[model samples]
Target: MHDPLQYEGRKVVVTGTASGMGEATAQILVDLGAQVTALDIKETSVDVETALTIDLRDPASIDASVAQIEGPVDAVFSCAGLPGPPFGELDTMLVNFVGARHFIEALIPQIVEGGSVGCISSAGALGWQEQLPILMELFARETFEDQKAWLEANQETWGWSGYLWSKYAIDAWVGWRGADLIEKGIRLNCINPGPTDTAMMPAFHELAGKEVIDSAIGPIGRYSTAIEQAWPLVMLNSTRMSYVCGEVLWTDGGFIGANSTGKQGGFGEL
Candidate 1:
């Protein structure tokens, strides 16, 4: 087993630390002895060395919050995300994809050599590859404002496509930039979790339909608990996994397996 004290005195940052898996992740990091700089739009109940209130949808808020974090950060958890439509498809994409990308990019210079980054995607993002062209177009835009303008002009095409496309962009960005990040001795990876049990899950059920959430449970017949989702994310950046890099680990409780075995519906249905 890896030493429990491995993170003693290390500094880390975790976004969306107010609740759900983000809260669990932040708590776990603190228990592992890391001094955490937590960020969220609301106050996080978890104890951290520093906590900053920042709205992920607002690029300026993210910039201001990140500026307050003094680093040589050992790790970063990009765990903030919004569930699909009814939450405004445009805003979902902004927070889930664009904002996360901006935050990760800004932290590149502060990462200590050999540090790692882990982000939360979702098993619901299974269709990411099919939407590559759309994501790449938005990805090329230089500023958050530019991306927002594109969203406004092309809102019809997005419809309820925001959450799905946002996760896709995140997965794609990590895949494309993994090598570049590694060149700086920093590894970047993400997790694609299935229906996880969190406070935010109710929003998913409301937006995607309760049947969708019910059907999404894997062979395990249940959604993963918040801490269950938190472990792999934290482990990806831990010292014990020094060799792991640029990979997207699926934490779907065999849902991906069922889909692979033809037991699940088409990716479009998800």
Candidate 2:
């Protein structure tokens, strides 16, 4: 339970911090003495006093907020995410993957050597690596507006699949950064948590119903409390995992071994 990585007075930026893994990660870092700036879409009055309301889907917002941040950073935990449904397919990719990349590109320079950029990717992103070429093609077009235009054009048809593609793209990025991060003496890694109990768990439960949620993940038979995942998350950001880059760590309990499909584990019978 004791985290050896000391964070006293270090600057750390954590996204999706209003709640869940993001919130837990930031709070733990703060307790370890890190000066944490937590970013999220919605606002909350409690928890860490340092917080920023951000919509990663908007390039201007990413630009503006990141621009205001001053000085060298110890780490960047890009944890902002969207599941599906509300944002549909295309929009989900735009925010979770593309927008996350945008924030990284903007802030990477500020992270000093020995710094880290960690993310919360999904275990569902497994075997999705085959689409990396298509994802690179999308990023080649660059510019959030251009990507947005492409999404608007193809969304009516391909949007749903685009979300999956975005996560896949992120999976590829993890490997790409592994080599690149070492060159700069920094590190990059990702965590793919299984079904997690968070602010959004209830929403997922409502949307999919127990038949789906119960069978989809958490091979150990229950969703991981946000805290369960944050420890490893913080460890990855620590020197302990500094040599670990371009790797995807699955902390979803035993879901990857048990749930071949992202569908809740109990659903095959339904």
The 0-to-1 C-alpha lDDT of every candidate, in the order given, reads 0.85, 0.76
Clashes in model 1: which pairs?
none
Write one digit per residue (lDDT tens) for candidate 2, span 179-258. Answer: 77778887888888877888767756665676666664664767788888887888888876767888888887776665
Which 10 residues in a row give candidate 2 its minimum summed lDDT?
261-270
Q: Give the lDDT of residue 125 in candidate 1.
A: 78
* Poorly placed runs, candidate 1 (over 4 Å): 1-5, 266-270
Overall local distance difference test of candidate 2: 0.76
Error of 1 at 104 (Å): 1.1
Candidate 1 residue-wise lDDT at 84: 73
Model 2 bad stretches (over 4 Å): 1-3, 45-49, 156-158, 161-163, 259-270
Residue 83 Cα positional deviation in candidate 1, in Å, after optimal superposition: 0.9
- Quick one: best lDDT, which candidate? 1
